[model samples]
Target: MAQYTFRTRSSDCPYELAIGLVSGRWKPRLLEVLKDETLRYGDLKERLKPVSDKVLSAALDDMTRNGLISRTAFAEIPPRVEYALTPQGESLLEALGPLRDWARTENGR
Candidate 1:
């Protein structure tokens, strides 16, 4: 399985590249909204309404494959699954805090 990384490009600023890694239309929202909790697929889909099922699935897969999120599958009569941030993901969220704050103030939110 191929994994994603921000270091793939050599010419870009490291910070910019790092920021770009989570710059997908839904990725930053996913990370921010999910920062405080673990969520099942259906719950996530509901919370991220307006996003197509295919796009959400692809974003989750990319984050999971890249080690940013951990997916737990439960075996039951009906299978259940959940997603939560990994240590790396938590750290990334912390790193984005200042940027988020800056944006908020700049936009007068």
Candidate 2:
């Protein structure tokens, strides 16, 4: 269930205040993968390397619903499909900079 919070100023739902769309365990990893380029479903699943089909499918649906990612389908005999991040999602790359800086500053990796 979704939790509720109140704003004495505007009184909006926390769902709208979410941190730039990527959430849950698999999502961040998915974004990391997509940062390079658009990819096919099989390529993503292979890069994720152990995620189950059901979990990945659900994650993809969630991202698409949140407007963080785009899915394109092509009309080929085999049906080509690819996934890429939206400009909104691309904007989040900068927001995650601090964490990357911290990881390097602390872990030295």
Candidate 3:
């Protein structure tokens, strides 16, 4: 696994910081999936079919580090892990509503 750091200079725009956090093929989709429900690793992997384990893991790690998602691991015998959006993530989703709506309208949906 690679190490990802979300770095921002003092002059960096707020939009750039926000975009940097969620800028990825899987990050946005991962956020969408965790928007309403908490799911296990396997469940998330299943929902995001065709996504490689490496990419999925990286995305989850990045989101976790950025404080957009929370990861919980249980101490059970077999081990249990779950993922869900954080409050910050929920706020981001709300902020993205206009963009989503614009896309929907553009697609005539």
Candidate 4:
């Protein structure tokens, strides 16, 4: 069975409530892509080619619902919707910086 971590301040889980907000493969990747600029749905699909549309949609929806990403709608001939990270998401990205550095340096990535 797929298990989720539910931890308190003293709980055994290494991360806190914040990390749990982005506890999936595509979540981190999605955030990484959105760190510098906004991306549209098709852009996301193109950038994350290995991920299926269904999985990408689910991850983006989850992030949006969790106050991580913002979805903007524009009235154009074909319509435009862009996604960007919210302040909370930006904070999360900052927090993960050190960990990302460690992962690259120590894990030889």
Q: Which one wins on lDDT?
A: 3
How far off is residue 53 in model 3, in Å? 0.4
State model 1's lDDT.
0.81
- The ten-residue window of minimal lDDT in model 1 covers 3-12
- Give per-residue CA lDDT, model 3, range 6-108, as digits (tens): 4322224667666777787888888899999999999999999989999999999888877899999999989999999999889888888888899999999
The pairs that clash in candidate 1 are none
Q: Model 3, which residues run further than 4 Å from truth?
A: 1-11
Per-residue lDDT of model 4, residues 1-109, tens digit only: 3333432212344474656777788998988999999999999999988999999999998889877899999999899999999988898888889989999999888
Tally clashes: model 4: 0
Whichever of 1 and 4 has more TM-score, that candidate is 1
Error of 1 at 101 (Å): 1.1
Q: How many Å off is the CA of 59 in candidate 3? A: 0.4
Off by over 4 Å in 1: 1-12
Better of 1 and 3 by lDDT: 3
Q: Model 4: clashing residue pairs? A: none
lDDT (tens digit, per residue) of candidate 2 on 1-65: 45543221112455445443555678878877888799999999999979999999999987877
**Range of the 10 consecutive residues with the lowest summed lDDT in candidate 2:** 3-12
Specify the highest-TM-score model's number. 3
Ranking by lDDT: 3, 4, 1, 2
